[model samples]
Target chain A: MDEAAIDVRGLSKSFGGRTVVNSIDIRVPKGRIFGFLGPNGSGKTTTIRMLCGLLTPDGGEGTCLGMDFRTQAEKIKEKVGYMTQKFSFWEDLTIRENLEFVANVFCMNRVSERVEKALKGLGLESRADQLAGALSGGWKQRLALAACILHEPEILLLDEPTAGVDPKARREFWDELYRLSEAGLTVLVSTHYMDEAERCHEIVYIAYGDLMAKGSVEEVIAKTKLKTFRVGGKNAAKVREALEGNPAVATTALFGEDLHVSGTDGEALKRLIAPQASENGLSLDEVPTSLEDAFIYYMNRAKEN
Target chain B: MFSRQRIKGLIKKEFIQLKRDRPTLVMIVMIPVVQLLLFGYAVNTDPKYLPASVILRDDTFLTRSIVSALERSEYFRIAGAVFSDNAGDARLRSGKDMFVITFPDGFTADVVRGKAPSVLIEADASDPTSVSGALGALQGIAESVIAKELKGPLADLAAVRPPFSFTVQKKYNPEGFTRYNIVPGLIGMVLIFTGVMMTAMALTRERERGTMENLLSMPARPFEIMVGKICPFIFIGFFQSGVILFLARFLFGIPVLGSGGVLAAALLLFITCNLLLGYLISTAAKNQTQALQMSIFVLLPSLMLTGFMFPFYGMPEWAQYLGSCIPLTYFLRIVRAVMLKGAGFADVAPNFWSLTAFVAIITLITMKAYKKTLD
Candidate 1:
């Protein structure tokens, strides 16, 4: 019910005769944490760039932060904070110097004060004098995040902000995002981790330049209409092999010691797996469909198309 | 045996990569050929056919014969004859002629009456090397003129030291000190070499480190970024120019004869022009190595053809035309005319205007080449 922060329709882009981003539409409501989930080379970074005015979409008409994305790109750029997929800050400069440079570029008053505030906010005060290149991966990501939000823009477009971060650091980063969102900042983040996707208020899955699905975590799962039955036993491998190519089953994947059999049709999937469960002495139990199950289903279905 | 198959495989891989890198391949093949042509034909130290002016006060047979004999020597080409010594001095100060031959009134009568007539030969000696060869030929030319002209009854004049004396005055640089010209030229060369190369690498370094994308995504304008990047180098340029000028004054004893204000203004214009050229090169180049190669390409031609190593007029017409287009050539003339000849603002206006035009054109081209949006 909140007003849309980023509302674009029919966005498309191509490079060297290949369509990298097809006619995809995206909408993120104000103050919501929106996650973009996709495989590698799925045009996630390209789409983020286009949304922030770093790139011009070949075909699209939209508005970001209440400004026309096409004609008023300069105005739009002023209100959006874009964090690149790479750690793009100056590596040779110290953390304080980098922050000061960005502050100066934005033409902010009280530069040293603002730099000190940003340093303290990110808990980077101790390493303020350290060169950015010498920091660990987590610290670099934190520094990039700190730099993007220095101007207090209305929206943040982060391209895989936590790609190579460790689990603990990733959790801390997500917490920071939650705090920012709580303070009414609209966040559009692209990520690959399923747990991270679950944390987002809404998620969109894209594969091979096409938008496969978009909704909240439970909504996306329910939209798939996927029925998953877990099989556990010493004969899990045999059960997996028997139910893999069945016409009734869409996917059979291993999850640790259990085999997940999923299909769109609930009854057919149950009926096909019952015979295998009985013959192989396997324990079969219907379980809730997970985001990973839906994602794998979408990925396989897209490959087929 | 030393694994012949592996060696062959490595060689094949290397060749394929080399072929794919078109810039490197072109540099490898073209650099040597270009260097050979530039050094072999375009550069000549023994400079001939230097332009000279004649001040003919008394038009006698002996004066005509002396002028004809000087022309036949092939070292001096008489551009035109001026009426007054002031007019001829202006021509020399403006670098129109390398030397001026002045035959005062009654010179031919004095020589025939056994009174030695003094012929005033004033030469521009800023670039001592360029005029040294031509000056050496003058003595031989004077002796030959007397030997050839004193025929029939006047042959005795040939035995008394040619019955004439040459008061050769080396104008601007009386001692013909080589450093007087070379030190000023070195200032231009140093500015070009460092200012252009450092600026050429500035943008490429950002792009290589992935920081350019971040900078572009910010609210900063293209002009703002360009100015920010170039201002530091401008300071460096002025600093370098000051250091060289100080050294030239104290260590080498090269005097700054003209107005310091004029020289400073010219230095500022020249430095800005080179910085703009470097920015233009950065826009065309894709990476740091390509930028460096581009800088070298510009540096080499300016060094060889900018009248720094060879006489500007001594070169062939085509080479001189090429030198006229280089910014360093104009800057060299401006610096020498100001520091050595004590030239004023009005004297070096042409070079000043040419450098200003060059700066404007290069700034426009560089602005056009720099794109705001990523493709």
Candidate 2:
């Protein structure tokens, strides 16, 4: 079998007597576009750090690219390009200068050629002379990615790289990620955006230091077994609030004029909503549960369990 | 190939970073130039214009001649009036004057009768400079005026011939030129103060901006990054020191009495210590503001205790002990010894080793303390 890009289990980390990343299992096959889904402060960054050998887990064993993690951090670092969540490149340098510096840091033999290729690859050649600080959010994001990938490592660990980027830029970034994955780079990106999550080949949902679920999108949805109902026509807010606290209802969110109500207790939810829909002159219909409802069910169940 | 490639690449990156950073560039160049000119010219502590108070109690012709002689010596500017009633005690207590000379009260009859009465001169011993000048002036006036009068009175009598003149010798910077002492010491101090303070906030600023995390994730090892960071500053320090030393020689006429080779070695040692110190400061500080504050606390005591502003001997006993422990203090001594006294290897060896030890200890601590985590 091809070597797994990242393979780990029983990972735990504590900070000042509080565990931030409890014993958890994580695996990403070679060249897969893997997504880690989590809310803020949800151990995602901690896991990424451990996997890239930037941090050593208190209790864990793992290998990245078939190399021992503890002894081979330098090797892993050499093989992976990590893009941090924040804009981290020196703002004083121009795009060209920033790329040249990164190339030097890697100590590439043909630095000029490498810098030229990275600039052109990122479509930043036009603005190569522009100060990195002057570049807009999108272009700056592109520049950061360019610097990270200049040395062309086998794996990329991007920590919420698209947090504040506009949609167009986010799309372009995702497109670049896909192209890199096609060229045999394993991209382990952590993102909160559902659309971004949907683009990944596989997804892992983590909450409060535990991996809640992991699989292909379809398999994860099937595992959730969430039955959803859409109730629409004016007064959706009142309906959403009314269905919110019901024991049978797992989650309720208002989608504009409609209320997307979901629960694992399909029969009880149907009984609870049938009478209200008829009396309020609203339409009630069965709808396919999306990743949103499945995630919500998993979150609610995780909370209870 | 690998080593050559890396070193060349790293040096290029360092220069690029240096070029982009304008404020740091300005500060490094400006502080030394301004300090050399300001302190070299304005801070004249070389013992001239001493204040003297005269008690002209005697109305004799010889005493009058003595008083006129005192006035003729420009070294002793008459700060206090010619008090008649021996008010020396109050004048000394108020600290308004440095010296009070009280000539004995007698008519010209006592001197003509060959009594050979003496005069009392009280000098403020608080300021060493004041006391030293006052004492020299007093000795000079008494011998000359007394010899002139005694020549007429006792030229025929050689039986009681006493020594008529006094000899004076100056120690440690004999001419007492500020540049000879200060510039040499300044070479040590300015290298450290600017070198460490400028590079102190380097990594921390990047860390605060969240750039360190990205850099950490890169393929480069920590040692590689560190060398790349410090090598450029070392070159800059060397260049700046050369300019300041040249300027001191050409513009201020400060002589480097010591061997240029030894001075160069001492300066190199000082720069390494400073670079290590800057790295340690950067490693320890959590943010740029903390780094800036820490630099102040480190450098202020460093400059003050190194005897840059005050002689090491002038400090209190405890302060002297503290000064001995600081590397800058020892380095300052070595620089001045070599550049002013023309000291050699035997002279600066102990200083060199002590600085080397300090650099080694701090570098180990910095290496151990710095971790690749946000926490």
Candidate 3:
């Protein structure tokens, strides 16, 4: 954590008299891609909104890039580039024109030169004259990012930048993010993809307006404290049905040909699954808990709370 | 309040966006000129040509002479002179022609006996203002011609019809010229055209596609954004105002009775108020469609309630009270009062204060609402 580029505590937000983001704390270091992961309505965007100084938290004190968020919002704004979930750009304007418009907003010196540099940076030189609306989803995203970074902000806040892109395209985007991070731009990105989460330097999982876990991807999976077992047989479906609703069973998910199950009390889970395994002639063995399993376990726990 | 550099950046950005939309800019200027022409030429209060039917019940020489004279007069056109002895009076109730002249069955014998012949002029009172003037003016010509004819026949004419009177004072425009009134009010419309079309598209655009968050996070304050958004419109608005004034003076030859400097100052205030109002609408709308619709809804009501079509003086008591609340109504009134009535600054001081307060209050509200962004 290099000087805690984003250090915040007890952040809370409310709208229409209901708390959307409750008391939460997050600390992100410089030059790292921090992934905010959670289900829909889990306050990931709201928390991101607060951290970037795009919004003021009702109850929080934080510094973004070593500036006080409440008082120095203008200063923080000058340093951060935020990519929203939605595609927002003038559809009528060409790619070059859109970049120029953003540059105008920043009032940067030598605007035409900066436009050339941004066009080259995003690999948008070939299509600079094309209308923004004519481009497909990936290109629109590239344009939005180019607009955000034209002023060369120190940090970038991406709210689900790769939501609908294909996996290959998503990989290409992450590569660009890694390159930007290596150049000393702190990144705070939110995504639900497990593999994408693993690529992050650290992960913060939030659910139901509460911060559930924060650590490296491997550490988060280990901290779930779940003992999982995999049952594979021709009658795995029947085994899943019988094991479900059992007090000892925490989760039962169909994974291709096998039924994966988990429970916090390992002894009780073993006792329950052993009988079902023998009756169905299914082979049972302890399995390494994947991130998806840990996520599901944590999500179900959040629901019961 | 914001830093000087940040405010400058916002202003520059706003100008760039404004330069992008051209069709809307054309519409703003077009609506005002079209409205001015529609109101100026189409709206005529003076009676130009009234259709008057004469039902001559008398077949005497004097009645024939009176009928011939009424036909030749410019005040009324003789549509049809039906013999009262032929068709019944049922046609009179159908409102065919404004006035009917019915002379009694005197024959020319009453004039020879030196007794004055009495003729009845029944006028249609449906639209009392329009036909009443024609009725009053026609009677003057008929009476003067009859008095001359009677003066030769009778020596003492003391008891003769005491000269039917025509008392008409055409207020505002004695010549009934269109350019006089329309040119003054067109100035206000031009301001609205330029100010509203520019500022209305600004904030909603950012919010519609999710770029507003990025802007809010920028080093720009809400008031700074607002000022930036309106500055470009103000310049355009003033330029349009100048064009309208030039058209009025050079093309139409309309007199600038009021202080040109004072008129320009009032126009600035009007445009400022319009920009502020546009900003308020933008903040209220979630998208461009919503903003555009709401602007129309507001613009239409303002065009009506602001006394653009009907005169504030001629309208009923309730309408005049409603007209006073509309900003455009007050602005138009001040512009017209200054340009047409030659009203000084002291006369228009109240209107200036009202516009100043309206712009100030709306601008403050938008600024306060914009500053309250949430996590």
Which model scores highest in TM-score?
1
Model 1 clash tally? 0
Candidate 2 chain B weakest ten by summed lDDT = B162-171
Evaluated with lDDT, which candidate comes out highest? 1
Listed models, DockQ each: 0.78, 0.44, 0.36
| Residue pairs of candidate 2 with colliding backbone atoms | B258-B342
lDDT of 2 by residue, B1-375 (tens): 479989999999999998976655765776576456434532333444455677766676667777677778655557766675346544443333545767656734555555555666665443344346445666768667766775754654323543232223233445556556567667777788888887787789788887788788776666666776788888888898898789888987766776888777777778888888887889888777667766766676576656676544334456657777778887876776666545566656777888888878887887887776555
lDDT by residue (A1-305, candidate 1, tens digit) is: 77999999999999998988999999999999999998889899999989877888999888887788888888887788999999999999999999999988888899999999999998989989999999999999999999999988899999999989999999999999999999999999998889999999999999878999999999988989999999988778888877767787877888877898889999988888888888888899999988888888888887787
Those runs of model 1 whose alpha carbons end farther than 4 Å from true positions after fitting are B60-73, B111-116, B143-166
Q: Across residues A203-238, which tens digit of lDDT does each residue of candidate 3 receive?
A: 999997889999999889889888899998889999
Candidate 3 stretches with Cα past 4 Å from truth are A278-281, B1-172, B190-198, B235-266, B286-301, B304-307, B315-326, B333-362, B369-375
**Global lDDT for candidate 3?**
0.74
How many backbone clashes does every candidate have?
0, 1, 0
Better of 1 and 2 by DockQ: 1
By lDDT, the better pick of 1 and 3 is 1
Global lDDT scores for all candidate models: 0.89, 0.75, 0.74
The alpha-carbon deviation from the true structure for residue A8 of candidate 2, after best TM-score superposition, in angstroms, is 0.3
Kindly report the docking quality category of candidate 1.
medium
Residue A85, candidate 1: C-alpha displacement in angstroms: 0.8
